[model samples]
Target: MPIVSLPVIWIIFIDIIAWTFFHLFISAICMRLPLAFFLKDRLLFQVFSWEKSGELWQRLFRVKTWKGFLIDGTIFLKKGYSKKGLHGTRLNDLKIFAAETKRAELTHWLSILPAPLFFLWNPLWAGWVMILYAFLFNLPIIIVQRYNRGRIAAITA
Candidate 1:
């Protein structure tokens, strides 16, 4: 590559590294943070809090506005979907589409990574790394949701 190209390559490399680190750091934070205090343990929050759910509903379904935004932001950023408005009508369809799309994307991304990197890099050690990252990151949130649900059920009963 030309000297001029070197800078561009360096920039791309830096960006990728930054992106990877950001994902890992955010995943760590999400996994570690407590969620029970915030969402009140609703079933919606519990089921959709993880990466798989987010990918399933948000990215693939391309659900309008809130659904898409929330799913993408949370899975990729370690946050939650908006609970503001009514989640009516096409909610189920949107979720299915998102899930399908997420699966495809995950497969594509995983396939592209170097297999040897799985052994060399802790983060990229295997495809399951992503799932582990998601599970741990979403655990705190799930716990919070479970607490909330118990409170709601008790109140209702």
Candidate 2:
């Protein structure tokens, strides 16, 4: 049950504002974290055996066909690393790319964690919509990051 009642328009407005804060705040925190934190592959960032080094995403999602259309969110931040494309063709550049993918993945994952907060003010169905919105907005990006990181691991191997 909602802790507070709000008109639908007010809820919509609040959702927009809240999501904006969540995205930027989470991104800023991730960005400020030491780069070393992302350099090593963490458990969550690992491409498990089932992923077949990211080919699963290629087969299931055809990521190549649509990934180009997704925005490079770093463009919005003042001092963020760009993940729009590879920085260069060197081994070091590729390693950096892989690390940045981990950072990106973590940011999206953290962004999804606050979905339940909407339940504090939303009706049952609307609260579920917020959860849906979280996944819908963030999951594809997370998939792309994982896919690219797996591909990078294959290349660097």
The best candidate by TM-score is 2
lDDT of 2 by residue, 5-67 (tens): 989899889989999999999999999988888888689888888888889999999999989
lDDT tens digits by residue: candidate 1, 19-104 = 47655554444434444332243334344334343343335433334332333334654444432232443645334333333332
Report lDDT per candidate: 0.38, 0.91
Q: How many Å off is the CA of 88 in candidate 1? A: 20
Give, for candidate 1, the lowest lDDT window spanning 10 residues. 99-108
User: Model 2: runs farther than 4 Å from truth?
Assistant: none
The residue pairs found clashing in candidate 2 are none
Supply the TM-score for candidate 1. 0.27
